[model samples]
Target: MGWLALDEGYEISLVEGKVAVRRPEGRQLKALPKALRDHPEVDRLRRLAEWLERHEAACAAQVDTWMVSSLPVPTELLARVWPDGAWQAALRDLAVVPDDDPDEVGFLRDATPGGELKVVNLDGETVRLSPRTVTLPHPVLLPDLDDVREFAAELDITQRVEQIHRPTWAKPADLEPAATEVRDYAGGVFPTRFGLAARATGLGYRVSGGYATCKVRDSGRAVEAAVWIGEPYWDDETATGALNWHDEDGRAVRLGEVGPVAWSEGMRMAAALYAGRRIEEGGDEA
Candidate 1:
């Protein structure tokens, strides 16, 4: 099931489908310092430690699929459990298994375009296949069995995947005015490096100043106009200073500043590069 990081103690969801602070034997932690145990924050840490330890053991025993929330666990605990550095790899194999399967699972294989490939939890409904590896939903890290069961009921589990895109990192492109104006006229928001590449490739829009400028064409005719987008950074305080959109002549043509946006343009640009796309411009500008 899911291990929720509570304010004081870690809540471990066990096989019986119930959340408990102690282990399966019902032995509660009684020796913890009163101050540390009572403190809401410290209590949370203790619970997380216990959760980690138990799950670590389970995984060591070769159990499959552990679901964890977005909260990052301490590196020490991760290392202790994963001495061989195969936790992530092991976990990937164990996701999306059926309810009847035990907590610990083994590798399963099937034929693919590249020949026979093995993945954790071959019996799982969702088989995420990639060129080099396969992945399944981690059971421990899942929100809860009920949630997963509900999900399975709603979604088909027998679908075989053809591809999985791994993440990558890349530098942002020097954008041109044509691209910037196209982004602006398209009523753009969160103009990420990836978005810029997409717009230039005719998949996304362009933006410039507040009003729309760039127009989309269909069959050599205009269809939709572009608009200026907000800043591309994650926070507002860092939005100052105009960014120079470059052109082919190596001169700056469009100018803009980082504005309030949720996602970072750099991250988006990196994702696009990971997807094997290129971003080009004419020159740079202020």
Candidate 2:
């Protein structure tokens, strides 16, 4: 953005998402001058920056939701949003599979105004695809994920939304059919329940009642995976508890009844919460 002139030979502009000031000679100042600290322009720029941050976060989140659910997105819609910087950042470099040809995986590169997409295929060649719809499959659903990752690394691909490199856990084949909870990530200690709750919210999970929950759609059903983090007002040291899944009606879902996407997403939430546990001086998790 170009600099705006202020009173007494002062100029201001947004730099690195912050309001920056400069002298009339065009030398950038380390900080805003005290005299102009409360200027209207400064406040306006600050608000603009905050809104931009929220908009970018929302774009990334929506893209993540589309990938997690393997939702088919229209090419025309993608083309419409491709020009926006925030949308481009969130959608760029993601692995996109055409609905007509599920076996062909390509890294998204560009979207044309005519509803065509240019993607870099496994052969390292840019190919044009005009499919009406494409699916950004979850890492768990991608065939030969290791090869995709290797190809992405070779191409120096960096995705704003964690797609090709997202951590995934496969549902175990030997699970007890009647089990309703998984204790693999249980017993992660935090000094206070607030800390545990904070970690859950920071990781984008909802802190509801005594559980940190994530709701996802899988196999055309709504499922919620929750890991007990403790009561909201509990101030004592707390430990994470078993992770379980529930149906839309709040009934406990048996292990065998949980769909693949729900299982992987539940395990992902559990592992993320556990990873933030307090560690003792001996390098062991408390």
Candidate 3:
């Protein structure tokens, strides 16, 4: 809106004080005027602009899939795609964990097909790593997790990277009225899943890269609940998770120990994510 306009394959932009016409590649430009509307160069730029726009959109969509899946990516593969500006931009700076240890997280800095992959380790040192697979971790599992989450929020990448660490109930043996409807995503960060994230955010909950968080009162006391979203392999249309609840003293509540309000809210959140999913005819979703 500030200066660029896309119509057909042509990009009409304001460069300095005059109208400039060119393809989205920013190559082959001509000054625009009413008399030059039929210029052959303008027609050529328009065609190139159209192709560029479509390619850009395709790249963005594919990158979105990679972020959502949090798949264990091969550095060699990334190196091949890194030549494309859009692809490189999307893959840069994401938190990655080596295939070996899920606990050792690093920030992806560079990739080389046959050379060492480079990353800034959790200790903030620049180092070359040769992990079998590099995975984009959900923000919840990153070093300085809170800070990483803050950065994601600033970039609005939360929902895209949903494979972050999910909060377990802390004591599975202590839970009561165990979830019969919950879908557990092994890579999911939410106990229930991602679909409910919007609803939680609309209700003033803090929807972070890994969880939808908020404090609710139960029996005149405040409890914190962090709802996790599951990983994509297990989550397709709807998302799910456990209700990680904290007591007035800020300790995790044991299973089946939550009061009426807390329990209702937890189930309600799960239901929100499950609301629009279509069940499969044979009991498996399509």
Which predicted model would earn the best lDDT? 2
lDDT per residue for candidate 2 within 32-61, as digits (tens), equals 788887888888999998998999999999
Kindly indicate the candidate among 1 and 3 with the higher TM-score.
3
Q: Residues 190-217, candidate 1: write the lDDT tens digits.
A: 3354344344345222444322122212
Q: TM-score of the candidate numbered 1?
A: 0.22
User: How are the candidates ranked when ordered by lDDT, highest leading?
Assistant: 2, 3, 1
lDDT of 2: 0.92
Q: Which stretches of candidate 2 lie over 4 Å from their true place?
A: 283-286
| TM per prediction | 0.22, 0.95, 0.45
Q: Higher TM-score: candidate 2 or 3?
A: 2
Runs with alpha carbons beyond 4 Å of true place in candidate 1: 1-286
Greater-lDDT candidate between 1 and 2: 2
Clash pairs detected, candidate 2: none
**lDDT tens digits by residue: candidate 3, 124-238:** 6777777777767533334566665555455444332233333212223533464332243222223334455655666445776666655545545566666665443444443
- Give me the runs in candidate 3 sitting further than 4 Å from their true place: 1-31, 113-115, 140-144, 150-286
